[model samples]
Structure formats: structure tokens, C-alpha cells
Target chain A: MRLIITTMAIIVAIWLIPFVLSDESGLKFGWPYSVFFTLATLFGGFLFYLLRMPPMGPFTSSRRAIGSVVLVFLVSIGIITLLANVSPQFAFEGAATAGATAEERGKAVFNDPKVGCFLCHTVQGAGGTRGPDLTHIATVAANRKPGMSAQDYLKESLENPGAYVVPSFDNIMPPVAKALSPEAFSDLMTYLKALK
Target chain B: MPPDVPLINDRLVLWVVSELHLLFAAFVLGSPIFIVISEILGVRTRDARFERLARETMRIVAISYSLTALFGAAMTFVLVARYQTLSNFIFQRFYPIFGLYATFIVVETILMYAYLYSWDALERRKSLHISIGVALNVVGTLVMFLMNGVGSFMLTPPSSPDRARLWELVNNATWTGLNLHRFIANIAFGGFMVALFAAFMYLTSRKEEDSAFYDWMGYIGNFIGVAALIALPVAGYIYTKEIFAYNATISTLLMADKLAWFFVIQGTMVGLLFLGAGYYMWLSIQRIKGGPRFRTYFRGVFWVALIGLIIWLVPQNFLPSLTTKPAGPIGEVAIPEKAIFLGLMPAKGLAVSAIILVTAFLYLLYRQAIATGTMTWGRIDTKAQLTLTFLPAMAVYTMTFMGAVRESARGEWHIFQFMADKSAESYLTPLGYAATVSGLITVIFFLLVSGIFWLGFKVGH
Candidate 1:
């Protein structure tokens, strides 16, 4: 059982990591189901491994704990049924509320159709993990640079995502001001100021 | 062609298309529930006979799944054809969630192949396989939640949403209620379907013991059906509450005078079905020599289910319109109060009747399970029992993670689209409707499926 789970999990992890990373979404099939399939395949491929080993508990029948079986069955069925009937709007609201926050709200400004600079930079643990972490730039710079304020440092980072590449990170931040109208640049700057 | 004929044709086309999508979703959504229940039943009673029940349910779902996928494909086309504006917005606004769905689609396809072939592999690790099935059902459910996030975003667009941060997506607010609602609905849908299948088998079987088998299975199915039916009201309330929380105006659209009446009618008919199922289970129990000897127990269930139905079916209110509007900046919208929620439920006077109805259904199930003699999975052949267990579990966990990913990443859609100057409407809203209409279609189509299954199996009777 351990082998089956381990082998299958590894294979699934390989697929999942890439599927999630870099975010190039190809319309793929169900991953959870595929993981079991992988486990099943490996189980078949390694059938000799099990047969050769001593059996556990005399290879007991697949019977298991059954108390509350009926109740569980009914509950499961009822839950699925309710889900099937309601509108999509309801589902989103429930999931959203469970995970909402202020940092997220401030971060959302980057994804705002109007001023979306946070998309490239890290702010308050939100946005692309691609950029340098900017969660406490003010405090850090106040300590590190001795005299430079947080606002000046952040401004330099935004107009130029590359100016000071944090050690070991890529120096690939494009100069966004070149892409945006002066107004857009200002709006993004204003949104970022509110974040501090 | 006459002008109205085209309009009528349009309605018919929409209905047919809708049925196809929903029917497919039903099978996709319903399969794992059937599998899990069967697995649970087989393991507990030391009876593999329950395994066969699970297989039959899956096979039926498999047949429908093909059609479901077909209609799913069609629904995508329908979006482009019928609801282009909405479709455009969905793609634009909900690109992140959609992207995740796209990735999972590949996973689902891979899993389907494994499901088709894993019988051999599972035979080797039968218990593990079963666990995987449990997990698969979870994944199936997670997929729905992720889809729901994208779908729900349409009707209730998040306020001042950060379209890019995945975390913001997590905070969308509607995902939990929608997920819970869908989860419950699938269970009910699956239970009804299994019962429907068993009923077909009983109606047509030639073997003397076949009646016994079908009767027992149907009885169990009926219990699930009735229980699920009872749970529907509470589920519906949660759903309405979520909608009210999101936007009272949309809730009003959903609960317009005529639509409310439609729901009342729907509730009444389903209530009648519950009573019918309970009655049938009661009769099936009579076939057993040592059935529960309590007529009052049976009578209680009937009257209670009836009363519950009548009470629930009562127009949205009984007292005068004492329900006042909520005072606030959002005051144009009627705030649904806690008192109003109470008033909407069946009157307390009928609570006893509802209890009896639920009790009767439970009694019928208890008696039937006792008589079946097949509740023990251990009694069935080990080799046969090993097939198809646990594949869905992998699906469940991964899909859940995906949903978690989607849930977490959902905020990123806003973050991405805002920078891109794209409205979430370009992707979120239309795709959601397409999914919605498709889900409804899947339901209608599956009912048609039950009818077909009935006809095919009935001939042998």
C-alpha cells in the first residue's frame, strides 16, 4: 500500500508541479483521477512485489468499519444533490468569503483593469511570486539604506522593475513606464502609495 | 416559417442543449457518489454484492458521461453561437480559473483511461483501490467547486476585486456556499439515479430472486432519495441566503412571483416522489418474512413528508408583508432578515408531520437492508470486488488541490485582466452560464437516460 501510494504520488506530483507553475493552461483532463490511475498502473506493474511478500492479517477481505454507513451514505448523497441544483453565483460567493482579506484587496489593485502594476511586483504576499518581495520595503530600506525612505525606494522599483535586482534573483524586471501612458503610471504609483 | 415558430424553435433548441450539458454533469458528478456508497456498503457488511450495485451505477454513468462530454463540447459551441458577449467576458475576466480548468481537463482524460483499465491493477490492491475511489469522488467534487468559482463570479461579480492575485480569488466569497450546495445536490442526484436504475431492474427481472435483489437495492436507493429530498429544503435555503448575500436584486429575479410558484410546484412533485419511494420501499419490505412490524412508523413517514411538502410549498410567506427592507447604503436591496428566513420555512405546527415522513423512509430502508442478505461485501468474489476502487480518490485530492490552487489563484484573474484591460465578463460570466445551462441540461438528459434504461431492462421482465 505504501509503495503504491508513494510511487503514484511522485508521478502525480511531477505532472502537477508543471501544470500549476508557469501557468500555461492547456485544457487537460482530471488530475486527481489520473493520480489513482498512476497508482493502479504501478500496482499492476509491481504485482510480483506484493505476491512475493508476506500477507498482512492473512490478506483479509476488503470489509471495513461500517458503523454510520447508512447515515454517511445519505449525507453524501444529500450534499451532492444540493450542489447540483443551486446557481454558480452561490458557489463563488461562499468560496470567496472564506478566503478574503485586506492584503488581497490592496494587491488586487494591480490586477485592476485601470492600474495593474502589482502584477509584476510582490506586494503584501500577493501578486506574481515572480517579482522581488515588497511586503516591507519601507521598514527594510529604513534599516538597510540608513537614510533613503520607503517611498523613494519603491518608486525607483516600479518605474524600473530592474534597478536593484535582489541578490540571486533575475534582473529581468522591464521598465514599465515605457509601456504605460503618463496617467496610467501615476495611477499605478498612487495605488502603490496606498499599499504603504 | 412563421415568426413564433422560430422563437419556439429557439426555446426547444435551448432546452435540448441544456439537457445535454446538465445530464453529462450529472453523470460526471453522480458517478463517484455511487461508487463511494457502493464501496462503503461492500466494506461494512462484508458483502461484495454491493460492489455490483456500484458497478451498475458507474456503467450507467459511463454511458451518460460520453453524452455528457458531447454536450459539454456542444455547450462550448453554444457560448460562441448564442451568448457571445457573455462568453467573451468570461474568457477575459476569468482567464486564470479557466486556465486551471484547461489543465485539469487533461488530468480528467488521463484518469478516465485509468478508470477504464485499472480493474486489473485494483484487483491487486483492492482495499487501496476502494480508498482511491473515495478520493476520486472528492476530486470530482473539487472540480465542481473550481468551476463554481468561475461560474458564480458571473452573477455576483466580486466588488473592487483584485483580478490578478490568486489569493484575492480565494476571497471571492461565494465559493464555499456554492461548493456545499453542489456537493449535496450531486449526492441526491446520484441517489435518485441509482434508485431509478434499481427500479428498472426490478420492473423487468425474470429470475424469482431478481425481484428480491432489485427490491432491496431500490429500497436502499429510496432511503437515500427520501433523505436527500428532506435535506433539499435546508440546502435550498442556504443557496438562497448566499444569493441574497451577493445581490438581492438577482435573488428577486430568481424568486419572481412565477418562478417562486415554479419552485413550489417543483417541491410538491419531488415531495410526491418521496412519498411514492417510501411507499414502494414499504411494500418491498412486506416481501421479507421478518419485516419491522410497525404500521404507525410507516404512517408517520408518509404524513410527515406530505406535511413538510405542503408547508414548504406554501407561498413564500403566510403572515402579512411584515418583512421590512434593510436600512443602509445598500438599502435599495431588501435585506433578508433572520425572521424572514424562519417565516419562509414550513410552519412549526407541521413539524411532527415532517418528522414522521423522514422516520418512515428510514424505517423502510432499515427493513430492506436487513432482508437483502447481500449487504456484506466479504461475501462477494474478491477478484470481482477489486475493480475500479480508489481511482476517483486520486482524482478527488488532485482536483481539490487544483480547486485550492484555483481558489488561491482566483484573485490573479483580476490582477491579470486589469493589466490587460480585459473585463472578467469576457470570460467569467458567459462560461459560467454555459456551464450552468449545461448542468441543467445534464439533469434533464439523465432523466431521459433513466427512461431508456428502464425500457431496455424492462423487456426482460
Candidate 2:
């Protein structure tokens, strides 16, 4: 009877987590999930404790040991299914909205998840160190090769990244030109060139 | 594809062969240090059981040494024939040390054989025999250190490769950390392998005396494993910190990007190891006269460990793949904004530390029980013996999974930023694919290990 009452209280607590934690805007925090997960884990642990108590613990008999294994396996599967179905999806905010100007549109393209330029190349101070920082790419591009124009160098870089290996960096950049539409590519170039 | 290896996938073959070589190599290198310690203890205490353990463990190591060489040779051949460019690059840089490595191997081989053969002959000259054993371990360790110099250089090469001195290449950013990590891990791996052998012998032994001896042996083996395991996470942390300090991108790749899920699985496996070890200790108490008195304290320990396991298993983000979009409702909803904090390093680090602490606490409790009460070694329940058997399986999987994570951290490069893998099979395998390959490798390894165990038994008879 005590187990039943305690379990009911726990369920009530879990059910009330969102309501208790959320604001007027319904902007839920991590508190609800944390509390719910902790409550569920504690409740499961309690059940385990009860099952392992004297008189019929898993270690007491061969039958009980095998039964415990099965029970644990089934519980694991159930938990996995529940987590898969109920856990919140990782929210990746959509790409920046298309801007009025070519440079703005190009900035949007660079920030696009599909383009993934921001994943490696730093614009100002934001990005991965795996590749060379491109904060001064507009100025550096013309000087990278003796005769190539800035636009040609940047275009060549997007199309064939391995052509000019940056010093101290591996030639690891993917072909962004293949992934981009022609217009998007032009806008991205414009945005990059305007960086200076 | 290399024309010389048309029938097989060269990379997969090299991966399996090299992993097999490492498995045997770990045992060969690790078993000796403990075996020598066991020998020293036997000499000091005049305990014949310790002497027999040292002799028996040496016999197994002797057998595995040949297997290690065989696999190593096969791996070398595959590398030279199929991955010619990589072979050339590594050889060009580290040719001088290769001779030193080979010389160490030869000396270690001679010492191992002499130590094994001179046991009865040096019964009167026991000090001489022990000296040889110590020398054997030193040479074996030197070989591993040399190999580590080559291996760690691949992942974290000298910053200025063209201008690097020989010492700079040998002592790369991650070299010392990798050496420390592997040194401790080898000890733990070696201990677990001993436990595995003891458990097998205990199960198969018909004589009561043999069962008692094997049971005690299993206990000592597990003791070594647990003691070394306690220090492993700290060593691993140092190694990871070095990787981060050297290259934040590679660290991010491991902790937050493509390889993040691999760590989640690794956490589960490591958590199981701790829990399994604790359970074995709990069951171990049943064999002591005053053991049941301590049973009540287990509940709290168990609960703390469970919480740690849960925390360690939590993912920072639930996204299965960073590159691919999910096909279900999971793709639609965002992780609770604040709950994300619970899955990060602070929580996971605390969780692992807690798990290790609880394991240490349980070991202490077991020790207390043993100190206070009389022990009946072979009288433990079958469940306890089964738990002992389960630990080695978890240890093997953890080792393999970790190896995959470390190797894959290089991603498309053969040597971090220095050499791009322009081969047909350069792309990183997805987590699912890698897991399948790892599982297959693990199964094959266990099968080979079973044969090695069988050979030990055969030699004993």
C-alpha cells in the first residue's frame, strides 16, 4: 500500500513538472525534463531495490538470477523505446532569412546548415579552427596567388578546395560550389568579397 | 584499390589484424609485470600458489607472444603492400627507432624464454631468476614506448613537421599522455585477462583443491584490475586534455560532433564495468563470515552507482547524426533548452567520478569484510563466478570502442593535418557501421582468445 501511494505521488510530481516550471509564455526550461528524468530513474531504482530485498533476491537462486536478467533486459528495451519516442528533438534553428541585398543573402547562405561554411571557417571570430580563418579573405584572396584576381581565387577555392593548400591547414574543405545554386554561389562570393 | 590485395578490402583487413595484434600485445606486455610481482611475492612468502600463478601466467604469455608477432608481421605486410604511402611516410620519419624497437623485442623474447625455463634451475638462485623477469618487463615496456612514439605522432604530430628534430617527433604533444594512459591500461587489461583465465580454470576444475586455488587466483587478478581501473579515468582525462590543448578541433570532433555518440556507448560500457565489479565484490562478501552484516550498506552504494550510470548515459543532444536529418518526431522538437545543461561535461564528468568513487568504496567494504572474517574461496555462488566472467567481456568492448574513437578522430586525414588519405576508403564510417565492425572484431577476438585459453589448458595437462 505504501509503495502504491508513493508511486502515485511520483507520477503526480512528473505530471506537474511542466506546469510548475513553465512561464506565462509556455517557455519551458530544462527543469521539467531534469525533474521528470530524475523522478523516473528514482522510481525505477526503488523497484530494483524492492526486487533485491531478502526472501527472493536474484542472488538467492538460479531461477531468480535468470528472471532478473530477463526483467532487466525488457526494462532496458522499454526505456529505450520510451526515450526514442518521447525525448525532445534537438532544435536546430533554420538558416538566416533571405536578405534584400546580395551581400546579405550571401551571409545567409554562409550561415546555412547545408552550406556549412561556418562549421570550419571563422568569419570574424566565430567558427572552427580546423580551417584557415576567413575574416580577411577578401584582402588575402588577391594576394594568395601572384596573378589570380580575388574573385577567381575565391571561386576556385569554393570549387576546388585542394588547389591551393593553406599553410598550416590541411586541404579538408568540401566543394561548396557543387552544393550551392549558381545565384547563391554568386551572392556568397559577393558577401565574402565585401568582408574587407 | 591496391592491386596486390584485390580479393580483400585492405583497410578492413589491416584494421582487424592490427586490433588482433594489439589485443595479444597488451596481454604479452601486461601479464609479465604482474607475473614478476607474483614471483617476488612467492619468493618472499614461500607461497607455492603464487609461484604456480607466475609460472602459469608466463606460459600463457609465452604462447601469446608468438601470436602477437604473427599478427604484427601480417599487419606490417598489409601496410607496406596496400597502404604504401602511409607506410613510406611513417618509415621515412621513424626508421632509426624501428631497429631499436626490433632489438628490444628480441631481447624481451630471450629474457621471457630464459625466465620461463630457468624457474626450477634457479630455485636456489631465485634472485637471478627474478632479475631476469624484471629485465624482461623493462625491455617490453621500452618496445611499447617506442611504438607509442610512432602511434601518438600520427594523431598529434609536431607542429612544425618539416623542421622537427628527431626528439621532437618522438615526444609529440600527445606522446607522454598516450604512454601514461596505455601503460596503466595494459596493466588493467593484463589483470583482467588473468582473471578470465582463472575464471575459466575454476569452472573447469574437477578437484576441490584446484577450484580453491583458481578462485583465489581470480580474486587477486580482479584486485589488480580494479586497482588499475580506478586510475584509468584520470589518465584518460590527461590524454584528452592534451589532445584538446594541441588541437581544439579534434577534441570537439570527439566530444561534440561525429564521434560523440561513440562516447555515449563507451560511457555505458564503462558504467557496466564499474557496476559489474561492484556486484562481484558484493557477491564476494557472501563468502566471508561477517559479510552479511555489511549487506545493508550496499543499498546506498547501489543507488549512487545507478544515478551515476544514468548521468553518464545522458547525451548532450539527442541528435543521432549531425550530418543527417532525423525522419521522425525527434527531428521536430528541440531538447528542453535548460535540460541540455545536464548532459554536458560537468554532469558527465561528475557522473564518471562518482562511479569510480563508488567502486572504490565498494572495494574498501569488501576488504573490510575480508579483514574481519574468514574467507571460503571456492564457496562463492555461481552467480558471483558468472559476474567475474562478465567483467572481461565489458573490458574488451570498452578497449575496442575506445580504440575506434581514437583512430576515427583523425577523420579524413591519415596523420591529422599532415597527410590526407587519398585512398578509396578515406571517409569516416558512420557510428552504426563502425559499431558493427567493432562488434565483429570483438567476437573474432574472443574466439581467438578462447583458443589461447584452450592452449594454456592443453599445455598444463
Candidate 3:
């Protein structure tokens, strides 16, 4: 009983903390934020649960240990796949989303060498071929058939690299999808979403 | 094309290759199973024949050990030379696991050598040598696990689109399950191959002594085969399920082919073998006379098995594949999902149910064999033993036939077909892997059976 309650309290606490910390946005933060925080926290807790047990013992714990080990091992792989999906510079979003107009924000980040993708990808038949040409990336990948919403594709490209690969190219892209500052990911997503 | 070994005796070449791998897989696959059987037989009879059979089987396995190693090398050569594209894909996509595969084979080879040569000396130190051999063969099975993972990995590379890296690709998701399936499958395959080899030899013997000797060998071989064969379908079911999960499309395509028909045919063979096996168990009761009490038991077991076989033979909707949820970005479109219910082959379900029924009734019917131990050829029955020796030889031939058929089929050489599209013999990979796996399995099965039977014998006394 105590074990179950303590676990629930930890869950409730994870949901409550993000709101308190983010009063600055004062955006109506609610359950969606709670879901992400809760899921992330639970994922972390599961890893902890696995770590405490020696493998090949109690069946449940052992199975979890092995499964967790595989999943933990998958983390880097997941990132590599993310890298395969998108431009590498999506790894960062500027600290300022405070007062800039949306289009100004796109221009600020668009060619900013620090996080701009032009360093690796060519656009408009110019820039670099070190990465895939992205001038039509929004058309080819984001708006690929079967309805990958432009927003989802843009976000995935930044986060998961292996999600889509142009034919003839092996998945060599680096994952910057998760690296996008959440604010930046959302902002960039909003920008890329409009491309289609 | 490098012309066929210029009018070389095709049969001779086939015989050589077939015999060599069968000889090797005999020792490699057979020894552990033989050891178990010899131990049980020895315990039951308190006779030197049982013990002598074990020792002799081990001794021959010892000789076959070198042969098996040599043939294994030939198989590797066969793969690289004959099936390079599929071979390259195997090496590249499955590099990490295949590396472990090489390690296991080296370990198995070394341990088997030690197992064979040291046996005479180890006879005085029986338990330890047997245990050591056990440990070595356990490692042998582990090698099978690594190899199975590599093979199964090709069939089902972990569908984790979310994961990357060579290790992740090799281990993938289905690796463990496939490994489990292969481990068990080999044991069954190994055991049955050995038994059939012995049985064939038993049937062909002319001399009374040879017939009697081969009969004992056959009994041991069949028991091993039946044990392995029975366990195999269960593991195979699980493997099919994993195949289903990894890619329904591939699974669906696979089920549509004649190869899927072969699976059914194999299941029928298994049913017959099961019934035949139960009948044989009945026959073993009257070792003093050629047994006659098993007739009714035979009929009962056969009828039950026939029902299972018939049920198994019933055709189903294979082409109009089951509907499945479309997996990626695609909406409302069906992605190939190997229908989970496909695992419940009505025939298989009936077969297992039949086995249970057979076991119950046959156990009641064959009380004579159960009550009195007559499951062995007498010490004087040298004919049976020698006759049993050659069945493995024929089995190798039969497998070579099936292998040819598998290779010649349509779309069987998907990987090689991709590369060798222009070549005349592009349809070689399926044939090659089948041949390699089958031929290796046969020889190893025999060598192991013979060696273990030899070990169980008390030669000097």
C-alpha cells in the first residue's frame, strides 16, 4: 500500500512542478504539459526500477532489467535516427522567444550560423551539399504522401533523423530533434508548418 | 560460368559433400542426445551393451569431429563462392552477431576435438568426461543460438525503426526469441536426423548381425529424433509469430508460396512420424521375439494422427490476406500484419491435442512395453547396429534433393536475385542456405549418435 501511494504522490508532484516553474509564460498550462512531464518521469522511474535489480532473478524484475537495458541502449540509436531525419542545427533554439515577431524570429534563427541549417544543408540551389538539399525538403519530406502534416515532419526532421531518407542516401543524418529548445522546436515547427 | 567440375561425377561430388556434412553434424548434433539416451538405457538395463553403445558412439563422433570441422570449412567456402551477394548482406548487416558466431564455432571445434580424443582416457573418469562433453556441446548449442540469431536476423531484423547502430541492428528485437526457436529447432533437427540415419541403416542391412546392431542404433536414433521433432513445432510456432510481428508483409508473402505448402507437408510428416513413433514404442515391448502386441496400439495412434494430419491438410485463405492496421503515416490503408491467429494452425492445435490423446491412450495400450523393458536390441544383435549406420547417409541424400527444389523456386533468391538478376543461376541463395543447413545437420546428427553409442559400450569387457 505504501509503495503504491508513494509512487502516486511522485506522479502527482511531477505534474505540479512544471506549472509552478513556468508562471512566466502564464500560458494556460494544464494536462498536456502534465502528460509529458508525467510520462518522462515514469520513463525515468522505470529505468530506476530496472537498475535496482540484478538480472536473471525474479522474473518480472529480470525481464524489466533486460528490457530496460535494451531500451537504454536504444536511446543513442533513437537520437541517431533523429539525426537521420533532420538538419543538425535544430539542436539549439535561442534563449529569446520573449518579444520577437514570428517572422522576425524565423529570420533570426533562419540564417543565424549558430543554429541555422544553411551551414549543412543547401537551400534554393545554394549553401552546402554537406547535408541534403532542403529547398524542397518541405515539399518532398514534410508533405510526403500519406499525410505527414507539415508541422509533424518539420518537428521530426529536427528531432529524429532516421524517420525519412531520400533514396540513394543512407541514414547518416544527426538527430537534433530533441536538442531543439522546446520553445525553439515549437517556434521552428510553427515556421516550417507554414511552408506547405 | 566456371563450368561444372568438368563431367565430374555429380553423384560423387554430391555424395562427398552430403556425407561430409552429415558426418560432421552427426557428431556435433548427436553426441549430447546420445549421451542422454545411453545414460537412461544403461540405468534401465544394467548391461554393458548400453554402456558400450554410448562409448562407441562417442568414439566414432571423435573421428567425425575432424570430418565435421573440415566440412564446415567447405560449407563456408560454398557460401562465399556460390552465394556471394546474400553472403555479403549476411556479413554486412549482421556483422556484429556473425562475429560472435565465428567465436562460438571456434570454441565448439576445440571442445569437440578435446571431447573426442580424450574419451578413451576419460572412460575411466566417466562422469567428468561426460560432463565436459556436455558443457562443450552446450556451447555447441550456444553456437547454434548465435548462428540462429544471424540467420533469423536476416529474416527479421529488429523492426525497431526507432533504434540504430550495428549492435541494435544485430540484437534487434526478435534476436532472443529467434535464438530460442533455433536452439530448440536444431536439437530436434539434430536428434531426428541422427535417428533417421540409424533407421535407414537398420532397414538396409542384409546380415543378421548387422540388422540387429543397426536396430538398436535405429531405436536410439528414432527416440532422439522423435523427442527433438516433437519439441520443434512448438518452437517453430513461436518463431513464426515473431516472423509475423517483424513484418506481416513478408510473412504474408511467405505463407502464399509453395514453401508454405512445404511447411504443411512437413507438419504432415511430423504427424505420421509421431504416430509411427508411438507404434514403435509399442513394438519395443517384446524384445525376445519380433513384437506383435503393438498392432492395436499402432492402429489407434495412426487413426488419431490421421485425424490431426487431415485437419492440418485442410487449406485456408492464404492469398486474400488478413486485414491489418496500417503502421506508418499511412491512414486507413492495411499494412501487412501476419494475423496472430495464424499461429493457431487448426491442424497444429488438433495435432497437439492428438498427441495428448495419443499419449494417454497409447500409454494405456503399450503397458507391456512400459511394464517390461524390451526397447533395445540384444547384445548379440550386431546386424541392427551396422544397418542403422547408413540411414544417416540416405537422409543426407534426401536433404540434398529438397535443397535443390528450394533453390530452384521462384523469388526464393530475393537477395541474390537482386544482384544476380542477369546471371543464369540467380536462384541459388535459398538452395544454398537450405543445402548448407540441411547437409550440415545430417552429418552432425549421425556422427554424434555413433559416437555416443560407442561411448555407451564397454569395449574391453
User: What are the per-candidate TM-scores when only chain A is compared?
Assistant: 0.39, 0.52, 0.42
TM-score (C-alpha, index-matched) for candidate 2:
0.77
lDDT of 1 by residue, B186-268 (tens): 66566666665564454334454664565456655655655655665566567668767765433442343112333433343
Candidate 1 local accuracy as lDDT?
A: 0.47
lDDT of 3 by residue, B70-123 (tens): 776776676677557656766776677777777877777777667666766876
lDDT of 3 by residue, A13-37 (tens): 8566655654344332344335434
* TM-score of chain B taken alone, candidate 1: 0.70
- For all predicted structures, in order, the TM-scores are 0.52, 0.77, 0.52
The regions of model 1 sitting more than 4 angstroms off are A1-196, B1-5, B8-15, B160-171, B253-258, B290-292, B316-461
- Give lDDT for model 3: 0.49
Quote the positional error of residue B245 for candidate 2 in Å: 0.9
**Best TM-score goes to which candidate?**
2
**Model 2, residue B151: C-alpha shift (Å):** 0.8
- Kindly indicate the candidate among 2 and 3 with the higher DockQ: 2
- For B143-189, candidate 2 gives per-residue lDDT tens digits of 99999999899899998765688789999999989999999999988
In angstroms, how far off is B52's CA in candidate 1?
0.9
Clashes of 1: 132
What overall lDDT goes with each candidate model?
0.47, 0.76, 0.49
